[model samples]
Target: MANTWNGSDDPVTRIHRQCRWSTSTLQMTDLESDTTSECTNRWIHIRHLPSQFNIDLLANCSEYPLFDDFCPYLPNHGLGQKTHNRSHSWYRTDSHMLELIFHRRMLEYPCLTSDPDAADAIYLPYYAGIDSIRYLYGPDVNSSFEHGLDLFQFLRHYDSSHIWGKHNGHDHFVVMARPAWDFSQPLSNDPPIWGTSFLELPEFYNLTALTLESRAWPWQEQAIPYPTSFHPPNMALLDSWVSRVRRSRRTTLMLFAGGGGVSASPNIRRSIRLECENSTSTSIGNSGYSKLCDFVDCSNGICEHDPIRFMRPMLQSSFCLQPPGDTPTRRSTFDGIVAGCIPVFFEDQAAKSQYGWHLPEEQYGEFSVFIQKEDVVFKGVRILDVLTSIPRARVRRMRESVLELIPRVMYRKHGSSLGLRNKNDAFDIAIEGTLQRIKSRLAEISVR
Candidate 1:
């Protein structure tokens, strides 16, 4: 809780609390009121804001604007404007500027950058677009990356180290991205921004039956569409969120637990039919096209789905698919867990070191099942019984554990940003702590 101890005459410490963010229930603080004589009846007052505050830009909702350069590590992408792949909704070639996204900051704090030369570089974590506002709301693609930079600039406390070019050793990496199969797509090589995808959490949430709305990063906004009355996913009118919430207010955040793709035999990178012995038919076929080919598939007959779709029926699934993307760390491993599906890995030596991020054995060991490509046939034999025999409670537990991580973790507030809160504008317990941890990690690397 916050240490806002004022004078006496305050309400009893047991007063109930309320938060604006929680969809299921409200929360309260646990503190005794100051009843001292001098402060008696002298209440520690706070102004309640109007119920409907526009959080889209965080202007009226924020107590104060963060400095532009106070925090030197965050980048100033100036509204994420770009000139590439006009078809890409996430990134646009026109009409977007990272600088103009927020109008008031520039005019109000012309001298926002206090010491631009102070910090070495900024690190912007990457996650799949599934978690970014752009994916849900549409485009701002390049702008999305820019906001990451500008947002940190808005804080003015630390600058993001997005040294994406041929830079090395100057900054720490902040991984944030989704699973993409296109090897042609460039993953930033910025310092302090390691790994490829932001889908780093265990894949438990991907397959569960829960309706999670609280786990997305930033918490303030949703990157993916939920099946709700306000933000409905498909045209499934029967599956309205309002009706679902009416039945039960508890809705778990929906996770893409995004999928990944493994390259064929090193010599056959362009092979249409994959020959992995023990892999799931996740979008491949015995004699069909691969998931990678699906995205770039041609609309007309010119682009035919060789085996009809991505996952081939004859393709076998293993415990874990160790397909790290172009930069390595393919999120498919995590996705398999969420979908109650297993992943298969074909060791690409270069990918191993590049994605040596949080491929932890402790937190994820209980769930994932890995196998070497050398023994694809025999090693994959046990997955059948092991996956089926897992208890129901174990599944639920995975859902809870992964969902709980949304707030205290990536979604946790690090500084003075207005976070996703309950109706009472409750503060998150992890914001400052998250910042400290990141700072400490950077310190460990001696990037300061």
Candidate 2:
């Protein structure tokens, strides 16, 4: 039987005092307090961009053409099979979900205020990403440009008192799932390229842009992670998944799941495939539609379509390869993290340069591996050899770190489908980061 102390100053009391010190929740530091305030206290004024720009785009999602770029390395098109698909809503397009999830999360945010006067930051929730994709695949070549032109005209006519009067919209921000390159045209006075000319507008330069990938320009575009499949309903589900990932045995040293047909110029996928095939210890799963090659130790060459298929290998592998696809950023980075798989990247911009708020600052090597693009494609460095060299203890530490990030990286489901509860997820982090940035920008402007 456990011994009971006779007095308040007995051994039991001392043990309780020690346990309190060890297990009690730590008080929020100054940094954490500021972060929480930026997320919940800062009033954000969301602009009413045309329904055609955001709402209508999703309403007509069924008509969206099959985009090979959306899935990237993954070959299968549909979200999950309807018969076996979970209760949650799913989509085939990979990059488009960021806008949808952001919209929902923002609407549900307690700090979202319609009154522009009370706002510290202005949110121009434009559905530019999906609209860009529509025009890219649509019959009309100039449809995207016209869409941007129309949006510009609307904002131009909007009461300047509502936005422009407040430091000329310096606090205004827009979240686009596409990279900045899509909207930003080259300075050669070139014809409209992939995206709209919205960013080119003078007023747009003042507003900040939260995008999947930021450009090299000196403007205010911030890089954010592309949406992944795992949107856990609550923190409990997320914790459970993290525990599972931590408990799972990692047999494969490294895993690369992607398609080969996406890029033609400096076909990194082909090089990766060759290296993975040549290396005996590595596991390679072809994520493309064409079942041309048999996947090493996988059921089929294609597992991109199945969310479970995509996540299983990642969860079971010690390292997940995340090479650039379509753009410098890949959704697989987020997917790998949720599965507690260490991401091995060929490009620095994908996650290292991007996701400064969501990911740890100045510590890319802690949770991820960076192999230079030239080294992988040109120098012929074997991924397996590079990964296997990492000490087992270090690998365990990195995996644990990544498992901690799962909650922060995820988009917690909101509303009746998932119930109403406040949980800090990717959206919270992005909002807080943007608000803090706006505050800093305002300070800089004042100082200048």
Candidate 3:
């Protein structure tokens, strides 16, 4: 469509050029010394790829599966259709549009350097999420590697300037909106199974990749927050949302809004649904247990159509049940945070081990509750009992903490300038974390 970067004399270009660092005697200490200066100065270099990798993929949205129309989500630079007639800023953002959202935000990133030689990190704006979706459920799963291999071959040309050769791409990073496991397929499978073998390729071993749900083991992947429906235009709108949720009159003790399609035996969701029904049945005259739980049966998939149907329960409940979906992570974890509801996770892989860059590891217990999946499924422990056992004072503290974490998990509206006090969003945190990680690696190589 259009050139991704503006002209050389454009405001964004001029801003970066004015603060571009001199690489003649750049030291590791200089990069690590000042965090605020690092954020304001030019450090990241965005690679210019052809439209086929990103913009053209959006143009061909109609070619995707007819059953699930993704065209509505492709507009407004992947922010999706706006929530019409709403006073607050909101959109029907697809969780898989992280690549699109990150790219749009990067266009406005102040720390971007047009000069590759002086950059600390290079961002590959490849939309692997959209590219791999067609291959995921199709019959020709074997052909899934073609587009990734092509992208790898295109980067081989960058070796002429030693861009890819410098430290073997340890300074390079890519955002894959899908789960890390979706691209971690084995090469030796007899009959081709689910997912592409993109991450398994030898060329990407040293690359620092970002995904929504990273694998638990030590690897190149890091987890970033999934895109939720709320994309506040500025800090004022964001603060308004936080205030409204904080002041909400929560009458329900816990809430669960999901489908019961899991056929696996000892299903934790089935147990949760059973407990919710039991709580509703015995609420006639029991003052202590009346209105103890709220349930929204998503088996018919109505929650996916209406955002209010999904988020209202979270706003009105003390705790939101976040059981594992097809994978360990669910978008609802971030959604609950946006609603100022304390998320009760069933597995460590859901949040604790996943989002090290965004969520604090030691402070996880302050905002969320962790109950083992086996305790609910195998031991027949009731969810209402466990949640009710938590003291009211501690629950209030946890909800306050969850409200404070709203900005870190959210992706702000593209090109919208934030107020001075409230600056860093999800994109800012990911870029900062990536740059620091690259700087650390370069320091190790310098001492070697």
Candidate 4:
């Protein structure tokens, strides 16, 4: 087992060590102050909620089939295909990684403080996304509203002595693993939808919520990317994988690895599939079982759900097709980026607006390709032509930009002793951005 720190080190010594390492390898030019010092100094108090709200929620893992990560590639990053000796298994459908990452990191994070009085913010570590999904498929699935009500009751009746009570929950925040659409269930007498009514509650108005996707309204909510299968245990491992990706040769112009492309639906999936099949250089791969088994040969479930199978083709392709999945944002976007492929996004809002904090603040053209959905659906504009139109040099720059953004888009190493010391992993950026927002909010309140 790695020697994980338990916040016992002297603050000055740790900060200086972090500074020395960060200045050498990582530099956040966009960040104003010293990121290592700011992140370590920002104290956060983790709320102790009942197991029902978090861990115990996944007790009956059978109901939530996605939690089943017993595949052959359990914890190997290289998916058992790569020749590299240092690799860890990662599952694409493992949405539970977000909760696991947070739970493990909070313990190791230097900012976390047991004392509420010294905390800069209160973190409500409720597994909101997972709990909601459990109810969505459980006995009282129709009455998902009850899930939100139960949480509201928990917060309203929570101990007022807690730091959350001081600011009417303004200083408190929660990290949700699912998109906001999963929790923003309608309240009216209209037909029932997919998710719970958690975000609809008045109690969550002031508190900050970090979700995989966020609605444009309610400025308190922030967008985060879905967790991917690539998790490097240390900076060396990360550097090694990145170096391999940089050296790998990419031949294909583009590729699309998705199912459910047939059935004549008006969805972009089918459109993308059609384009991929028609293109000369593009390859279409399959993984998850889809009803389009007859149209596509691989749809017979040949491509098993594994990290290598999903990302290998991506690494060989120059561009990866990213159409909206069930939600506006797809996990494939991050996968494509990590694989060093330039993502071609059909909807601008999907990646451009959703991940403002973590993604580069510059124009989307710098790192990705954007073709308006209407162009493909109505105008019949060919995806291949649009991609081919871009100059080769521009495409190269975009792919390089995507490669640089990999560390920021990826989840940090879980249970690391350094606690994002020299790396700018996704968790580090999210927490740092959240802290900055909290400080700004407190400053605004003070001035008012």
Candidate 5:
């Protein structure tokens, strides 16, 4: 202080001193730590930037890098002609598929994973199944990478565990570089004790690859609807409903919602032949007709919601024949109940699993006939006998109940009674609701 100039001193000298001091301080700050210059040309460093923006810029600048990093492309894969805004085959649009878009992106943003045991998140195969074709396109094994050239982001595709292994480098995501299901290998590639995706634990919070199911098993694990386990469309009348569709037109028609079409046995295969439409009889194959109301592969599969063209005849028919696909307890069986047409369960082990929550077994037993698969026969039984015997009054009520079911699955006009299918949306409303509940539960638990 004794050596410093007083207030009357020269402004030039003071200004120079201040400038030098400020410049030294700025240089010190610049040299304090690393910057983007230090990470130049590193892809991993680049990827980390979006997540590693400094605290000062994080509040707003952070989201931009991630949004920019995501796939900047649109899919043009012609799924099918658009109908109901869906791929005409499935229930939604190409944008909803997101399969192609997700696949191409992983190539550019491959997650680095050195260990397969790291638990970070689930690699769900979006929909579910092990189709054979994608295997040729990509590798079908664990302990190996498919050269990772195929474009399927589904955790179920090439990876065997469905337990997406996280890149040890990032705490936020399970960097999955491979599909979880490969057909070329044995089924035991992933054993449950170890490989089962245990995401409910502390791992699955932030994710880089994700898809969600629109519906799920109602949580009371012990609470399965007998003959089926379904949450009726939310729009359905909450009151107990029991009804059957009244058959119109004197003409005979039989619709098979999910017949033994794809995995059809020689006998069940032969049975569709005996059934007739408008006095016209034809075999399931070569007759140029299909027996499926809808042939569903997983939404994860190549065919989404593509109703088997053969199923169209069933829709037009007075009676729809529904049996479970590979498994019995399914959404389709309920669809039939709600459709009001009689169902022939072709009773199997699956029928036993469900307590038969909605089937009118106690009252309208005659409406739904359950014949043993083995007895389906050689009996050469014709469907006409069942329809002729059922009372018209009972049929009308079934139809009423069926119509009631559709609106529950369909979206509504917000404040109106009229309903509609879920227009294309990736942010599944139901999934979001579940996540919100989970988050709330976590918050509540944390407080405790």
Candidate 6:
């Protein structure tokens, strides 16, 4: 029998007491009183899923396609390995860990309610991102939809209260680590093009999804930031990094840290690389344009092993070149924002059409530069000439704007007890957005 004293509280009671204290502290320090009340009223209920959908996927990571050993990326509650310093909050976080990170963060969310009837929104903790990888490269492509089908089938049968059936999943949300394209595979493709048909199911139609990249139409999906290496545990550490980047001495005009042939058209990356190489010798008037650009040859996976090699160049450069890789979006866009370097995007779809929930469409010019892919690849337009033409004053303003957006794009370290006053990081913004979306949908339904 467990030890029980006459006047002592039980273990469950003690845990509840701690949770109440933590929630109260967060309410007083993190958000305004009004915001706290609003969040409290909008309670979330996380669905208790089977182990196979989440934990089992991580336990058998090696069996996943294309990865030799995937266990390293699953440590520290999906924050990956701590890089260099044990004291600092930097980790070698994989971009695909959004599902893991978001799930862990949601578990600690103050708005969580145990009573399903009182929940304003339902959270489906499915590891669709990691689960999709299993069927991506194998001959069993047709079986890619099996896991998703199984998940919804279980939900339909096991949910005694019909939580999802209440609004046809309009009030429920899921965070997908991968892009929307990976789950939107059409069933009519003769050879079955690259992705699973998870999104095509009639059951997922009304569900709200947060993904790294959303489709152009964006009916039920919203774009969220990809996880970066720096996960600050407190506002102080985040502020320190921001101050350091603001004070960084940028000597290079531009930087391209990735390799070529990542996109279907190799010419785009090739053109950018050639420009970076040729600019080393070319000079413009008085700006030391001879050292115009720096390029890191990440062809051998050096950037993955050591992020400093990729981040150092970004730190010293005024702008980071972000070309489309496979898709119109790249994780490097968020990396540039974290380093306080202005992003130079080659496609409108890369930034303008995507990330509308976090990054306002009107503010694109304030923090980033857009160069047409056609102009760079086909017209042979000089990247240096265009960048150099921008006045020093404008560049400084853009960098400042980029720095200001750092917190919104970052995922705060899970289980952080430190108080963050009046600031919402990526996770907070995502939850607020999801709740607001669900609230609005529920209100509309009530009127009918």
Candidate that scores best on TM-score: 6
lDDT of 2 at 131: 72
Tens-place lDDT per residue, model 3, 1-448, is 2333334553234323322332222343234545438455347777766656776665545454533556667656677777676635788788777888887777666666656677789888888878887677544466765538777777776444467776778888899998999988876655657788788888788788899999977367899999888888877788788899999878788888888735656688878877777776455243243378788777755665467877888888888899997898888888889998899999999989999889989999899988999998999777777787788789889999998898899998876754822578888899888888888877887898
- Cα lDDT of model 5 overall? 0.31
Quote model 1's TM-score: 0.30
Residue-pair clash count for candidate 4: 7
How many clashes does the backbone of model 1 have? 99
Worst 10 contiguous positions by lDDT, candidate 5: 45-54
Question: In angstroms, what RMSD does candidate 1 have relative to the true structure?
Answer: 18.0
C-alpha RMSD for every candidate: 18.0, 14.3, 5.8, 8.9, 19.8, 6.4
lDDT of 4 by residue, 1-448 (tens): 1212234342223333443443343223213254437655487767766556765553444454443322222122112222245444243435544654565555556555556666788787676766776556666667876665666677667655445557777788888887887788876625566777778777777788888889888778898887777766677667777887787677667777766667776767777777655644223223111211112223533333455666777777777887776677877788888899888888866888888878965857789888888889778988776876777788778878888998889885554436335777888788888888887887788787
How far residue 204's Cα lies from its native spot in candidate 6, in Å, is 0.6
The predicted structure with the larger lDDT, 4 or 6, is: 6
- Name the runs in model 6 displaced over 4 angstroms: 1-36, 85-87, 261-266, 288-290, 444-448
Error of 1 at 152 (Å): 20
Please report the candidate that would top lDDT against the real structure: 6
Give the candidate order by descending lDDT.
6, 3, 4, 2, 5, 1
True lDDT of residue 358, candidate 6: 75
Expressed as tens digits, the lDDT of each residue in 245-270 for candidate 5 is 33433133355544344335545433
Candidate 2: tens digits of C-alpha lDDT, residues 318-389: 888887876787777887898898988887777777778888767777898888878867787766668767
lDDT of 6: 0.78
- As a whole number from 0 to 100, the lDDT of residue 447 in candidate 6 is 98
For each of the candidates, give the backbone clash count: 99, 2, 0, 7, 29, 0
Error of 4 at 28 (Å): 29
Cα displacement (angstroms), candidate 1, residue 440, comes to 5.6
